[model samples]
Target: MDKMEIVEKHKLLSEKIADADMVLVGVGEEFNEDFSDIGRFPHLMSALEEVDIDQMLEWTVPFLEHRFLIEHNDGRLVEAYRNLYEMVRNKNYFVITTCIDENIKKAAFDTERLVEPCGNHEMLQCSDKCCDELYPSGEFSDLVKQAILDGVGLDSLEIPKCPVCGKPLAYNNILCEQNYVEEGYQRQWKKYTKWLQLTLNKKICILELGVELNLPNIIRWPFEKVAFYNQKASFFRINASSYQMTEELSDKGISIGMNAVDYLREYQHL
Candidate 1:
């Protein structure tokens, strides 16, 4: 199909979702550009490259400042989220995103209905796994700023420590590879599961956006499973590539092989 055909195909998302009693959206890592695009945030990249941290800084700094990093990504992602919310906000919908940078949270989507199961940088956990206690992610921000401003290694700075065993505190994101403090998102996870239970016999619209096989079980495979069983489900799989619908769900699925951002922008234009 040509560009116009793709746009027309994207329009079906809104029309199809309108028929569903509930909408479910799964956001995956492919929706996000990699750090190679970090040139847009030169200052942060400089800090990350020059000031050596023990470990978590490599992953945490970007997320710590993602309000700036993500919001300024040419406004494409933020606009995409807004476009998505405009379509699904009024419905009984739940969004589960693997993008851990909190960019989606910055959108106007109902927070109670959103879950980031891969974890995010909003909290901190003990580097030594000393306890399940969590702290605000910003507790060490000043120290990071000082290290960057002074052009010194973070090891020379006093970092926040775990209250229990006095080990350094680490960002709670799964990317940082700390014990990760899964309990942080369990409440919302439960909410998402409960919402899925409600969708079993109802008309559901499953929007699988930019999902790759990187974490298939989380969004890709499970979405296929749901659509396969729910006779009333309409599944739309959107990606730049790899948008093939599972065979069992072919009868009820649409695979739009286009960039997720572009697809959402098409909705915005409509």
Candidate 2:
């Protein structure tokens, strides 16, 4: 679509969401557009460039653990998210995101209202699944940060061991083929699903922001299905590309191919 068309669509989409009785936000990697150093997958891969792909899991543990802590502790959220958060702050809202950077928490969104289905990096568990516990990673992340700051190789430092089983611990994130312990995440998931049922007839808006087409089942497809069935619900997608909605949802869906941050900036002013 042309610039003028996009601008007009943004206006209508923003209005629809702003007037919504309930807002459901779906976020993905693109939500971290500005915080590339800590949240970008490419940047994280660069940090493990020396390691072979076979040892990616072994190397990524420390790198991702540290990045998680750094991002969680970072005070300033990207302007776009901050603004977007404000737009839906007053509305009854829930967030489902694939991002594990914890930016939503940093933006001061309520934890109970947010769900990270992909798992978060700030927690670690035993690789062997010896225990049902998830440990806070503050100490280990701090040690890794200090080692990097001192210009020392991480190889010398001992990998964090599970206190219960004495086995090496892994980042709690859901890596490929890895076991994911959903002790905490499950609660939020239940809450979101319950909210979905309770708000079925409400004036809802499923806002998909910066999401990619890679994992439609996670948020994209589900949002579309929900909006398709709910006559009062609207599905609005803000993406740089691949913003097309399915034909079934065409009546209640709107797609704008624009950067999430830019669109949020425009929405914030209105």
Candidate 3:
């Protein structure tokens, strides 16, 4: 869009925030700029494809390492969250994201006001989720690094097994949803629910960035429901393609078709 149009949208969003008692931001899959993709890690994908059996960690261990190795201090993900924080910093706001990366924390967002229910890459849990415990994910990453330095294949190393069930260990994310443990983010979920309750009948601003159908129940559907029910709420949806608001909410929210990252970056810079 043109500069004047961009400025107009920014002005509208600012007005909504300014008039609200509570502000909520929902970040979805697009926020995960570092997430593994064939375009970004073709070798990893090829490795997984060549394996006969489930050689997931062959891909996963390296995946975690790749995510951790990135210096977020100057990365786009950190910059996006930082730009977003500046707009909502002064408002009574809470941020929720499906991304498991630690960039939000790196952006210095208030821990008490942010939640990531999809799980984090830095933590591990039993593949079967035999217990509520989550282990540090660094152990497997270290093993992968050592093997790389030793010029040996990962097959030569023993993957960490779950202590409770003797099953394989996995990242604490939805990929292991067969029996994913929720303890890591359950408390924060409760806090988020309580915060939502407080928004009822109050002036609120809801901004959803790059959200999609990946977990509609958690964000998309609920956000639309809240916006429709709360007459005092103003909503904005930004995405490259899936920015359409529900017909019921079209009058109440603004849906802009654009890349969320680009929009945030430009919005901040301009």
Candidate 4:
């Protein structure tokens, strides 16, 4: 699309955002740029395929922790997240994301207003399920940072141990075969469920940002259902590449093939 078309879509989206009583933000990996190269699933698996399954498991856990904690910094919080914070700060809104990054939190979004089903990198859990407890990752993150400062690699750092069971601790992110602690996720899900029921007939807008069809069953399809069933609701898609809505939502949906950050930043001034 041309510049004018992009601007027009933003205007229309802004209008819908302003008119809605509540905004439901569905986010994906595209929201953060720092780990864009690391990739997900098959791509990540290909990179680690050389290592045996057992060795890969040993390397993958801490590798992910270092990626989010050591490599990523607050500087990566782009203008789009900031502008989005401004747009929804005073307004009634909730965010649902599949990413484990802390970009949204760093941007000043309320913790109580977010639901992260995929977990986060700032926490850790016992590997043996010794207890249903999660430990803060600040100390571990600091250790990793210190190791990097000393020009040492992740392998040089000692793996953290669970204080209760004395076993190795693992990052609290959801893994393919590993069981994950879901207390925090369940709490957030309860809050989201309550809000969803309360706003069933209200004027709601689903702002799908950088979310593709990767895991449509989780947030994408559900958000589409709500927008489709609610006569007064609308779905606005902001993606830099593929931007589309189903036929049922063609009339109520607005698709803009523009960078999410750029669109939100432009909408901030408008």
The model with the greatest lDDT is: 3
Error (Å) of candidate 4 at residue 109 is 1.1
Candidates 3 and 4 compared: the better one by TM-score is 3
Clashing pairs in 1: none
By summed lDDT, the worst window of 10 consecutive residues in model 3 runs over 63-72
Query: On TM-score, who's better, 2 or 3?
Result: 3
Per-residue lDDT of candidate 3, residues 47-75 (tens digit)? 34434365544544544344444433556
lDDT, candidate 1, 54-167, per-residue tens? 465454455336434433544667778888888887889999998877767657888899898877777888877777888986646655665656866545656577888998
Residues forming the 10-long window of minimal summed lDDT in candidate 4: 42-51
Q: Write candidate 4's Cα lDDT for 127-215 as tens digits.
A: 77677798888787776556555644445666788899798877676752255777648888999989888777889978888887677
Candidate 4 backbone collisions, by pair: none
Rank ordering of all candidates by lDDT, starting from the highest: 3, 1, 2, 4
RMSD of 3: 3.7
Give the higher-TM-score candidate: 2 or 4.
2
Best by TM-score: 1
Per-residue lDDT of 74 in model 2: 38
Q: Please list the residue runs of candidate 2 whose C-alpha ends up more than 4 Å from where it truly belongs after superposition.
A: 32-35, 38-61, 64-77, 148-156, 265-269
> What is candidate 4's CA lDDT for residue 43?
30
lDDT by residue for model 2 over 133-207, one digit each (tens)? 888877877776666556565565677778998987876766623566767488888998999997688999888
